[model samples]
Target: MRLDKFLKVSRLIKRRTLAKEVADQGRITINGTVAKASSILKEGDELAIQFGTKVVTVKVESLKETAKKEEANNLYSVVKEERVTAE
Candidate 1:
């Protein structure tokens, strides 16, 4: 599935458009490499997202075209979450 779609369907981002913007700005990476909004994602892929002062990392567990609130968390597993301190 597309990175932007996965982000929204998984509830990682509030909306697909926001996710696309974030990806386009280079704030997201897949498997340690920067990814675009249209990046292809597969199960077991790792995603690192830079969100303002914090960075969130998650591993893709599954892909769903649509997920309910309770099912969203099943799409990915949170690997790490850290706050970035500006130098």
Candidate 2:
């Protein structure tokens, strides 16, 4: 699955366009490497997303074309959520 699509379908960013913008700005990484909006994602991949003053890390659990609200959370497992304290 594409990173942007997974982000939206998983309810991470609210919209695909927003996800794409975020990815394009280099606010997202896959497996500790910077990733683009069109990046390919697979099961078990770890993603770190920068949102405001925090970073959220999630593990890809599954991929689907579409998911209901109740099922969206099952697509990825949040591994960590930490505030990005400025040094």
Q: Per-residue lDDT tens digits of candidate 1, residues 58-84?
A: 999999999999999999999999999
Best by lDDT: 1
Whole-model lDDT per candidate: 0.98, 0.97
Task: In model 2, state the lDDT of residue 46.
Answer: 99
lDDT of model number 2:
0.97
lDDT of 1 at 71: 98
Poorly placed runs, candidate 1 (over 4 Å):
none
Clashing pairs in 2: none
The clash numbers for all candidates, in the given order, read: 0, 0
